[model samples]
Target: MRFLGFCLSMLPIPVIQQAGLALDRHLGDKAFEAQLEELWSAISTANDLVSKVSTLEEAIQEIAKTIEASPTLEAKTSEFIASLGSNQKEFSVLTENQSYQELRSSIVHADISNFVAIGGSTNVIQNSTVNSERTHLHATDNSKNFVDGTTFQGSGGAVSMRKITTQGQISVQGSGIGFGGEGGIGFGGGSSISFGGNSNEVSGNCPSCNELLRMDKRELHKYIHVQCHKCKSTFPFKLPNA
Candidate 1:
């Protein structure tokens, strides 16, 4: 029994050496290794936390920027609040809708008159007065206005040039008539016929008369019998052979 106990206590050289190595490995360096591992784990956890927080903070800031940038949301919210607080109807009102449309239209279509350019001479004034179609005002030195077409004109631009005037006369006389109509005719701007105080014949007759009367070849041919409507007188208008 004693020998067995002593043998057990001494043990084998390989077993003893292995035991010492295990002790050194487990007890001696274990504290430092554990401490290093613990510190590394803590540092890793802290880094992860920091990364998560930074990501969260960036997300939050982005959300705030998005909110700030959204005009429709803010404007709608404000309008809703205003409507709720005021006497505004929940439904659309004509005036409000019109105002909204007008505001949007004004924003979209801003007038820029400076971009517009007016042509022609500024030295010559624009004639706003209405003129007869028969008359045309020129921009010459006299600004000579001429009646182009035949117009039975009295006054008030009734094809009489009572409206617009350049620098010359109120109504200019025309040259001649053209085409055919009810004792009246009109043509393009090129042709003209006009009347004045002196052009009017005052023989004091209604249907008037053609002053030029000459014997034509029709009266000399055969024995041409003609009856006058005024006197009912029948007369042979044939000339005797010489």
Candidate 2:
């Protein structure tokens, strides 16, 4: 029990101090110290029970029962700390699937220019920048069925564009995950420009192709050059400090 006391003493001083303060508020310093000592003894007993238990599940059940039966708040706190370690171990095991590992590896190795993962669990970009004439990005998950026994599972889509200036147009659409479930969009800085969907006609015409220029407010901020789909000719437009 001396070793157990030492281990408990080595825990974060602030946590123990906070607990002591709480106990002192109700039980006084002398009673709090006595309760803390008793808690260490309970922890030692629980450790011994864990060693004697046949299986991990049995040990957890027994430890939970012991914690529930504790008379002092200190003992209950010690039990809760022990439970945190067990929960962390269980979490590691739950995430250690071979398929998940493979999926993670594939995503890590993939050189994704325009990524669209549909109808499955997949990883998305954390941060990225795109500089191009026209950037058309779309990630749609329309699959009715899911893999790996996960019913009603939806696909995830993410794009991060920083200091992006598109010459022509940028169309981004991500729709339908699990039965009318919609995907989300997150943009930072000047990347918040929206290009396609509904078009509002601009005042000018294309210089090269002589076609009418049509765009939205978001597009007008990002695109300095416009392209005509009819003639496939690109033309530059003059904007104020843009």
Find the candidate with the highest lDDT and give its number.
2
Clashing pairs for predicted structure model 2, backbone only = none
Tens-place lDDT per residue, model 1, 14-122, is: 2233333333444356563464344334333433432243454443333323334567533432332222112211111011111110000000010100000012111
For model 2 the local lDDT of residue 84 reads 21
Candidate 2 per-residue lDDT, tens place, 107-223, comes to: 111111222223321212212222211123222332111112111111233333332222211233322111111222333232223223222223467676575644333335556
- Candidate 2 worst ten-residue window by lDDT: 100-109
TM-score of 2: 0.20
For each candidate, the alpha-carbon lDDT, in order, equals 0.25, 0.33
Model 1 compared with the native: what TM-score? Answer: 0.14
TM-score of each: 0.14, 0.20
List where candidate 1 sits over 4 angstroms from the true fold.
Answer: 1-176, 179-216, 219-223, 240-242
